[model samples]
Target: MKQLIIILFLVVIGCRNETKSDEEIDETVYDMWGDFTQVHPEFKKDELPESWYFHDNKEDANRLADLVMKGKKKASSGLYLWYKEANADLPKAGTKSIITNFDGTAQAIIKITKVDTIPFNQISKEYAAMDMGTNIEPLKKWKKAHWDFFANTMKQGGNEPTEKILVVCERFETIWPKKQ
Candidate 1:
């Protein structure tokens, strides 16, 4: 019957549309990277920038990432010992990286503008202010939060936290998804 044929045709179209949506979802991240490369020709098409969230857990990661996207956070610090223990390369000036949300959704790209290694006890108030996620008591908040975070990192790396431990301070500029 004509009505039966029409129903079958409609069902077939819906199934095809669903398949197309599934394919798009699978390629979403790759497509985002490719799109970035298209806009910034300095980045190589074959090489993708380092993609990572800002912090360990989902809540902190998403919060810090949102701060970066909003231009509120311009810098970050990490334990030198942690990097050495993990044998991870330190972020270098002039290097670009993709900042992702906690769920690995790419949000922004940032270019490292400067890097400094200084003792935890010697981190200046100016530097602390530069890295703040909020505007209040930059030095006090930074010291407390970073000290706690670094203490945990030191424990995980099999090292004890110390006031003299070297901290790698990285300052960056958000380069992609330009502010509207």
Candidate 2:
């Protein structure tokens, strides 16, 4: 009985030491965001998806709230399950502004840049799967001008067009992890 008690005491103490306290865990998680920023230039807190639940810590919440109030933060990506309304004024292509729920009270405004587009020949195959159909012939006709604009923009940005597409797509996915 005595030996069992001693073992139990030792185990408790060992577990306490190994498991980080709440404060320590919070600091570690907060620091992880800082480290991520250092490595990724385009990463922003506001870009986190609406479905993402962040810590309710006052400091962290306040920081995000301040950014939202100032319109400095914006949603970049995500499954965005709660975003039922898509702004009609925003173009169906490229970057556009959006609003999403950040926390219960705070809302995040985000600039979403859509990197994917339907190829002219594949439009029929792509649209066939959708219930809603529209005349995308205009879009197909504008492909050359769009391609030229994209190419020139890439040149101006000093990025290879193919490389930029890959990077932007990856970055967009990172901001909004796919729904399980």
Candidate 3:
């Protein structure tokens, strides 16, 4: 009876401690987000199905998503230092990323055509305007808003955002759900 109890305890602990590969985990847990294609009604046969969102909050993600569908927003930038710590590779040019609404509804697909890194303040007004999602004019509001967003996001993650941080600016073209 003692040996049997020990064996059962070991089996339970082993099951509880089971680890899964990234793909396996993402596949199972992400199924609740719904089939990515279901969210993207206009997905084409040749395009790859992947998903991303603009921000952690639903309102911002959904807002940027609408702009993407309308082609008002054509580019985006991200803090590269975080990616470096995450050991994530840069998005390859010509590959697609399916963008989702804040609620996890896949809405549009974009094919990254170009990518480069530059200091935060050095970003051109043209690119900043292209990337800004709000009605706020980039020429007037880009630096302050971007600095606040980046600083708070980094601070919440336990780091400080600085102008020297390399921003991964990407220019992409809408591929799926092509305008109209």
Candidate 4:
């Protein structure tokens, strides 16, 4: 009885000390944003960029994110229907985003340089190559991977994936974690 209560109290205190408070987490993100603005000095301090990671799978997401940090993968695409169905705003040029790791820690900041809506079948070989992580037949790889991803997304939205479906393509530059 008394021994059980003492053990529970010790566990609670230990957990509280080990866990990061919300303010501490927010400060980490804020510090990253601040570090970014220090180099550019054009972006305001109060407006924090949207933070997100790529891909649904954790390992895939981390790999893609690291590629972005390395400045190898400069572009990406998403199914427009996914945004519409979710009522999410479509990405636009000039907007900044904090690309995060699968664990939700900031990896780099990117500024969208271009945004275009293209039919899935119409994505150019050059653009597909830019979006891919590998040097091999990038267009083929991009088509296979994006097709599977878009099909899954469309199925969840109660829609069917088609070659004519629009994809929001974006090109960005990693502005933070600058060249050392």
Candidate 5:
């Protein structure tokens, strides 16, 4: 009788141990976002997607933003850089230029010397006039400068236009946690 009792006790303890181990493993698998929040306390109350790792403090947030911005700029610059290299042998003024996304999923074909107007309603009618001409030189310069500024500001914890865009995109890419 004692032998049987001892065997049952051991079996119970083993089952409990197995349960505990499973719980720990599950916690570990989901801890990446939790760990990020711990490091960045400011985001403790902010709602975020499961995949997003946001920082709480201004400094840390800035650092992450910078990294993301740099990545975006690198991606955009590569598009224009390729255009310049491809037309190196062609005449400068008449060369056609095209910039495509890294995945080659989207492209914009632009002609040099054509002027395009961008109107802004947020600003006064006189203040919102932006003429983007189809000069390859100016276009490339604008793209580089715009990307650099955006990346740097994002790194410094400033909000960016792209952030909203990312949020919409994430709905499709991420598997949201079930409601508690």
Candidate 6:
């Protein structure tokens, strides 16, 4: 009986000694929207979620959101300079994210499957097609629109685009808010 008690005590002490360090514990902690339940009645307070983005204007954002929710679109790209000015954290593989509409309504959650930084002129047709989310838009049209948009955005930030500006390209999979 004494031997068994000693063994049990040692086992408990060993397990206690294996407690996680501060850094490890901190990684598990996250901030969640307090009033999320007001917007999403089914949301749980304790659940930690991914970053959300309002990708564009009403029509474009809604279309892209629907495409993402429907698994029709798989990628997105944005001006790297814009993100830098906003101090936006870069998305990574396996990380989940939410899509929001212009009025800030949650649309769907997506899991980042791939991420890369590429020059605007070097952007592949596949990336543009994915961004379009509908019928394949010609590369020429995509370039014209993106160039104008980026140039304007950069000018607003007190910067100017050179011959080649870098853009962040991301591909993702819809992970939540499935169409039932």
TM-score winner: 4
**Model 3 agreement with the true structure over 1-180: per-residue lDDT tens digits:** 444433322222101112334453334224422344566555435444455667546677778889888887788776775556545576669777667665455566678899988899788878887877444577456677667766765665567777787887888887665323
Q: For each candidate, what is the lDDT?
A: 0.68, 0.30, 0.62, 0.70, 0.26, 0.58
Estimate the TM-score for candidate 2: 0.21
TM-score of model 4 (CA atoms) = 0.79
- Give the residue spans of candidate 2 off by over 4 A: 1-139, 162-180
Among all windows of ten consecutive residues in candidate 4, which has the lowest summed lDDT? 10-19
The lDDT, on a scale of 0 to 1, for candidate 6 is 0.58
In the range 33-143, model 5's lDDT, one tens digit per residue, is: 354457668655754321211122344333333333232211111112112223322113222222222221112222233222221112122211111122345444544
- Superposed model 3: Cα runs more than 4 Å off: 1-47, 133-136, 178-180
What is the TM-score ranking, best to worst? 4, 1, 3, 6, 2, 5
TM-score of each: 0.76, 0.21, 0.68, 0.79, 0.18, 0.65
Rank ordering of all candidates by lDDT, starting from the highest: 4, 1, 3, 6, 2, 5
lDDT of 6 by residue, 74-136 (tens): 776666655555455665787665565444455666667898889888988777777656555
Segments in model 4 whose C-alpha atoms lie over 4 Å from true places = 1-27, 178-180
lDDT digits (tens) for residues 5-54 of candidate 2: 33322222101112234443333233434444556556655333222222
By TM-score, how accurate is candidate 3?
A: 0.68
Cα error, residue 27 of model 6, in Å, equals: 26
For all the candidates, what are their Cα RMSDs to the real structure? 15.5, 21.3, 12.0, 11.5, 25.1, 17.7
Candidate 5 accuracy as lDDT:
0.26
lDDT of 4 by residue, 1-180 (tens): 444433322222101112234554444466788887777687765578766667655787788878888988888887665555445577778888777766667788888899888999999988887788577898899999888866764555456889999888888888886334
Candidate 2 residue pairs that clash: 74-109, 74-110, 75-110, 78-176
